[model samples]
Target: MKATRLNLAPWLFLAPFLGIFCLFTVWPLLRSFILALQQTYGPGTTEWVGLHNFRYLLTDPLFWTAAANTGRFTLGSLFVQLPIALGLALLLNRPGLRGRGFFRLTFFAPSLVGLPFVAMLFAPILEKRTGLINATLHRLFPIWDPEFAWMQEYVMSSLILAALWMYAGFNMVYFLAALQNVSKDLIEAAEIDGANAWQRFRHVTLPEIAPIAGFVTLLSVIGSFQMFELSYILLNNTAGPENRGLTIMMYLYQSGFVVGDLGYASAIGWVLALTLMGIALFQRWAARRYEER
Candidate 1:
């Protein structure tokens, strides 16, 4: 009996977390999965319709559009955000850079701002007239039309720019940590072997931090897919002109709340979850293959 009690004590201590996790996270996920298999009209009004929601989703054009937008954002993060963060991290990691703390803080301040706040702040700044960005562009190049509607004309690009400003610093912090962990001795040995700066970084620093880089990439991809608040707040809760900025999450929100199709929304959520899981698995496999090579 004493041995059994001792064994149960650990679970006793873990009970709060386990209970909360089951009630909040696990339960909701399970409920959503079940809901996705049903047809919902209102609260407490649902009819089981197995596989119907999934079938409709596969045929839905809006679903495909949302997926494309999300894919674009994910690709932009990989191609644009990653390189910029790495470059800034490398620059700040230099041996004798002055006022490094201030520079880091300046760059990282945007990430500290809440997503809604960032969107609200940029809305006025990107406005056609009396906007900071247009005003500056007018001052810099008077030949060009200053009244260009950026959010309307370049919907995804505009969002990408805002995202770049918001997340570059966040990713830079990770890269900076990775850069610091790189051994100075290895770098010096590479230099002694007549390796150039790029060669040393390519051979020594990059390989050492590749795991962290991969982790950052995975996180960025997940965040891109989950983007809703920024576009919602920026585009005034409407998917931008032509639905260019419409993302899967935003569509899910609309279908579940606006259209009162809770079952459909739940289905969208599961599709997103499955897609993210597949991408994460692929990333893990790719990372392992790279390491082996």
Candidate 2:
């Protein structure tokens, strides 16, 4: 009787959260998936059309381009952002770094500044005519006549740098937390023997925090795909000249809201959900394998 009561108490306590999740997340997902296979146009008119939307997606050039752009952004963040973040984490993790508190605040302040502020600040910095970047370049080098439109040609590069600036420190905070939990006694023992910094990191610290690192990687990938507000607000939703910043989310917005292709937009969203789930599962598998090894 006591065991039954205890089990029921937990479920009773969880009822509100479970009810909310089902009402919001689960219901919307299932509804969207159903809508993806049906033509959703003109009020009260939904025609069931299986595979047609998928066929359209397979043949769409812009869909392919958007996928490519998203992939590039994800990869670019991994390449640039992860390394810089990890480096900062390492530097901060060191035994005696001067003014650590001040540096931590300065580094993380950019991320805390929020998207609206970042966009407002960077819009002026990257404006082709009067941008600070071009101004400095022209002042330093007479041959550097950047008559080419920065918005058109350098949108991808500009967004990647912005993403790195906004996110790297946030990621560093995670790494810093992970590193601190590491067994200091083990690292000292490793140091006593002939292990160098890289050796200690690889053999001691890295393994200890492998799970956190893997989780952070998955987070970064997921976050990259969900990139929207920055480009939408800053680049004016065109991905800044030639749709170079047109992420999958932005594309979904264009289709669903701007163009009013509700059916096609739902299909895109369904695919995105599936993609995120797949990535998450794959990351889990990879992490499991790493642990096994």
Candidate 3:
């Protein structure tokens, strides 16, 4: 009886969490899967479609466009944003740096600002003639074009830049923490072995921080794939000229809410979920392989 009661106690404590998870997470997930397999006219009407939605998604040009744009943004985040984040973290991690706290705060402050606020903040700054960017460029270089249409013409570039500003510092915090935990003894040993700065980082520091780096990379990729709000607000709630800024999430939003096609939206959502899961599994496998090496 005591053993049974002990077991029951743990379950009793976990009852609230389990109930909430089943109600919110599990039910929603199951419903979405069911919705993906049906054709819905509205919230009330659904027709069994089997695999039709998935088949249609394959031939959907707009879906492909969104996928391509999302891929590009993901690549940009991985290569560009992450490196900049690591560099900033490295710079800030240095000992005897003057005003380290102030610099850290200054860099990280942008990330604290919400996406809508960031969008509004960058709107004018990215504008053409009188905007801060083009105005400064035109002032510095007489030949530079002040009338460049960033939002309309260079949509993805603008989004990437905006993301860089907002997220670089946030990612830096992770790298900074990882850097702080790196072994000073190993670093000093490398130095004493006549290893240069780059060599020391490569041999000792990098290996120590590689796990954190991988985690951060996974987070960045996931975030980039899920990007919507900044692009939506920046492009004025449109997909930008020629659908240049159209992302997978944005497409899902348009389908589910705007176009009133909940079924199709569920299909897209499942695809995204599966893709993220695959990427996560791949990252885990790669990390294990790297650790083995």
lDDT score for residue 122 of model 2: 80
- lDDT for model 1: 0.92
RMSD of each: 1.5, 2.6, 1.5
TM-score of 1: 0.95
TM-score of each: 0.95, 0.90, 0.96
| Model 3: residue 208 alpha-carbon error in angstroms | 0.8
| Model 2, runs deviating above 4 Å | 1-16, 42-45, 141-143, 146-148
Per-residue lDDT of model 3, residues 154-198, tens digit only:
888888899899999999999999999998888988898999999
TM-score of decoy 3: 0.96
Better of 1 and 2 by lDDT: 1
lDDT accuracy of residue 257 in candidate 1: 87
lDDT of 2 by residue, 96-116 (tens): 789888888788879998876
* Tens digits of per-residue lDDT for model 1, 36-61: 99888765688899999999999999
